[model samples]
Target chain A: MTMIVKKTTQLIAGLIFLYGIYVIIHGHLTPGGGFAGGVIIAGSFILLILAFGSDFLRLTREEAGSTLYENLAILIVVFLAVSGLLATGKIFFLNWIPKGTPGELVSAGILPLYNIFVGIEVAASVLTIFLALVIFKEELAE
Target chain B: METAICIIAGLMIIGALYAIHAKDLLSAVIACGIVGYGLVICFLLLKAPDLAIVQIVVETITLIIMVAVVLDSSREEHFVKPDGKGYMSMAAAVVMTAVLLYFFILAVGMLDPFGSGSLRMASQYINGAVELTGSVNLVTGVVFDFRGYDTLGEATILVTAVLGVITILRLKGRK
Candidate 1:
C-alpha cells in the first residue's frame, strides 16, 4: 500500500519464491511437496500484488501464457504416466527411470519429476486464479 | 504436551464458534484461519511434519482467497430476526451435534491406544518404502508411487477449478 510496504515486499518476495523452489526441488526428501511449495510460490506473488496494488496486474495480463504452462505441466505428467505404461507394460505411473541411491536428489524415479510438474501446474493455476479475480474486480469497479 | 494440545483444541473450538457467530465477515474469516492454524499445530503434535507443512500453506492460501472474496463483497451481514423456521433449524443443529458428539466419544473410546492401531500397511510402507521406491521420504513415496492415481485426480480437480475461475471472470467479446 505504501512505498515502504512495496519495497519490503519486493525484498521478501524473492526469498519466499526461492524457498518455494527449494521445497519443490527437495520434495522427494523433504516435508514440503509440490502442492505446498506451489502454494508458497503463489503466496509470494499474491504478497507482491497486495503490496503494489493492481499495477502488478500488467505482468499477469498475458493470461494465455500462464494457462499454457499450467496445461503443459499437467500434460507432461499425464504423458509420463502413459509412457510409463507403454514402456513397462505393467501399469500406469510405473517408475521407469533408474532408482539411484535413497537420499540422492535423482534417486526417486519419476517421483521428483511428478513433484516438479505438479508444482508448476499448481503455481501457474493459482496465479491465474489470482489474476482473474483482480482483473474481474477492476472491471467491476470500472 | 497433552495439556498444550488440549488448550489448542479448546482454542480451535472457540475460534470456530466465533467464526460462525461474528457479524464482521472479515473477522470471521480470520477466525477460520485461527482454527486452521490450530489444526496445523495438532498435525505437528501428531508428528506429521508433511501434513503440517501442507496444512499451513493451504490454510494461508484459503485465507487469502477468502479475504479476496470478502473484499469484493459487502462487509457487514444483515441480521434477520429468528422465526419458527430458524428455531427449528437451530434445534436440528443441536440435536445433530449431540448425536455426532456421542458417536465421536464412543468411537474414540473404542479405538486402540495411540501408535498401536492397524499397523499392517503402515509397517509395510515404513519398512519397504525406501527399498521399493528409492525415496527416503515414505510419505512422498506413498503419495507419488502407491497413490499416484489419487494425485492425478486431485490435479485434475485443481485444473478444473482454475478453468472455472477463468471462465467466470472472462468478459464478453474477449478471448
Candidate 2:
C-alpha cells in the first residue's frame, strides 16, 4: 500500500508507454502491428506496477476494471459482426465493410476496429491476469 | 545474432536451474519469468511473432498461477531458504548449462529464417482463408477462421476460468 514511484522509473515507464502508443498507431502499415503494440503498452504498465508495487496497480485496475473492459471489447466486436449479419446477409459476415482508401487510418474497414478490439482485449486480459495473481498472492502464496 | 543466441541460451540454462533449485518460491517464479523471456527472444529471432505472443501469454499465466497456488498452500518461511549451497547444485547447473547451449546452437545453425521455408504454404492457406472467411490480417484469418474451432475452445476456456474465480472467491468468503 505504501508503494512510491521513483522519478527515474516514472520517466522510463512513460517512455515505454509512448513507444507502445507509437507502435499501436502505426500498426496497420508496419511489421509491428496491434498485437505486438498492445502487448508493449501493457508491458509498460506491468513494469511500472512491478517497480512501484501493487498499490498503484490496484488503483489503476480498480479504475479500469479490465474484466469489464475485456467483456466490452468482445461485445463491441461481436456486435459489429452481428450487425453485419443483419444488414447484408453476406456469408462472409462483417468483411462487407468497405475497404476504404487503403493507406489512411480508417481505410481498412474492420481492420482498424479489429485491431482496436484486440488491443483492448489483450491489454485488459493481461492486466486482469496479472492483477488477479497479485490480489491472491497472499492467499495463494503467503 | 550469434551473441544474442548465446545470451538466450545462457539465460535459459541459468533460469531453468534456478527455477528448479531455488528454495524461495518467489525466486523460482522470477527465474521462470527469466526463462520465459529468453524463450521469447529465441522465438522472435526465428520471426515467429504469433507463436511468440501466444507462448509468452500462456507461459506467463502458467508461472503466475504456479506461484500463486504455491503461496496459497505453503508456509512462507519454509520455502524462503535453500537447503544447502552444495556440490550437487553446482553439478546440476553445469550439466544443464552445457546441454542447453549445445541444443540451441545446433538448432539455430540447422534452421533457415522461420517463415521463409513455409512461405508458399502459409500464403496459400492465408489466401484460401480470405476466400473462405474474408477476414483481413492473414494471421487473424488464420487464427479466427481456419482454426475457428480452436478459437471457440479458447474462448470457452477463458469463460470457465472467470467462472472458477467467482466460485472460489465466494466459497473462501463463506468460510
Candidate 3:
C-alpha cells in the first residue's frame, strides 16, 4: 500500500514462503503437513498482493495459471495413489515405495510425496480463491 | 493448565458475545477474530501443535478477508431498538448457555487430566506406527498412510469448493 509496507513485505514474504516449504517437506517428521504449509504459502502470496497492489500481479492471467496448477496438483495426487495400487496390486493408497529409516529426510515412503503434492494443490487453490475474490471486487467497482 | 484453558475459553465466550452485539461491523469482525485466536491458544495448551498451527494461519487469513470486506462495504450496522421479542431471545440464549456450560463442566470432570489422555483407538497407531509407516510423526503416518483415503477425499472436497467459488465468480459463464 505504502512504500514502507511494500519494502517490508518484500523482505518478509520470501521468508514466509520458505517456512511454508520447510513445513511441507518436514511434515513427516514435524507437526505441519500439506494443508497448514499450503495455507502459509498462500499467505505469503496474499501479503505480496496486498502490499504491492493487484495490478502488479496481473490478476486475470495469473488466476488461470493458479487454477491450472491446482487441478494438476490434485491430479498428480490421485496418480500417486493409483501408483500405489499398481505397485503392489493389493489395495489403494498402499505405501509401496521403499521405506528408509525413520527420522531421516527420505524416510517415509509415499508420505512426503503426498505432503508435497497436497501442499501444492492447497496453496494453488487458496491463492486462486483470494485472486478470484479480489478480481471480482475490482470488476464490481468498475 | 486446566485453569489456563478455562480462562481462555471464558475470554472466547466474551469475545463471541461482544461480536454478536457490537454495533460497528468492523469492530464485530475484530471481536470475532478474538474468538478464533483464543481457540488457537487453547489448541496449543491442549498439546495439539498441528491444530494450533493450522488454526492460527487460517484464522489470520479469515480475519484479513473479513476486514477487507467490511472496510469496502459498510462500517456501521443499523441498530434496531430491542423490543419484547428481542429481550425474550436474549433471556433464552442466556438460559441455553448456562445449561450448556453445566454439561461442559460435567464432561470436563470426567476427562483424564492434562497430558494423560487415553489413546483408545490411537494406541495401535502409536505402538508400531513409526515401524509400519516409517514416519517419525505418528500423525502424518496415520493421516497419509493409514488414512490416506480420507485425506484424498478431503483434497477432492477442497477442489470441488474452489471450483464452485471460481464458477460462481466468473463474469461470463460460457465465454
Among the numbered candidates, top lDDT falls to: 3
Mark the regions of model 1 whose C-alpha exceeds 4 Å error after superposition: A56-60
Whole-model Cα lDDT of every candidate shown, in order: 0.88, 0.63, 0.92
Q: After superposition, how far is residue A13 of candidate 2 from its true place, in Å?
A: 3.7
lDDT of 1 at A34: 92
Supply the DockQ value of model 1: 0.80
Interface RMSDs of the predictions, in order, are 1.0, 4.3, 0.7
Taking every candidate in turn, the Cα RMSD to the unseen true structure, in Å, is 1.8, 7.4, 2.4
Instruction: Estimate, for each residue in A12-116, the C-alpha lDDT of model 2 and write its tens digit.
Output: 878977876665564554444456666666677776666676674354445347778777876665665566677787643355677655455555545556556
What TM value does model 1 have?
Answer: 0.94
Instruction: State in Å the error of residue B175, model 3.
Output: 4.0
Ranking of all predicted structures according to lDDT, beginning with the best and ending with the worst: 3, 1, 2
Residue pairs with backbone atoms closer than 3 Å in model 2 (clashes):
A140-B71, A140-B72, A141-B71, A141-B72
- What range of 10 consecutive residues in model 3 chain B has the weakest lDDT sum? B166-175
Model 2, residue B169: what's the lDDT?
Answer: 43
Candidate 2 Cα deviation (angstroms), residue B143: 3.8
Q: Local error of candidate 2 at B138, Å?
A: 4.3
Worst 10 residues of 1 chain A by lDDT: A55-64
Per-model TM-score, in order, reads: 0.94, 0.62, 0.91
Classified by CAPRI criteria, candidate 3 counts as high
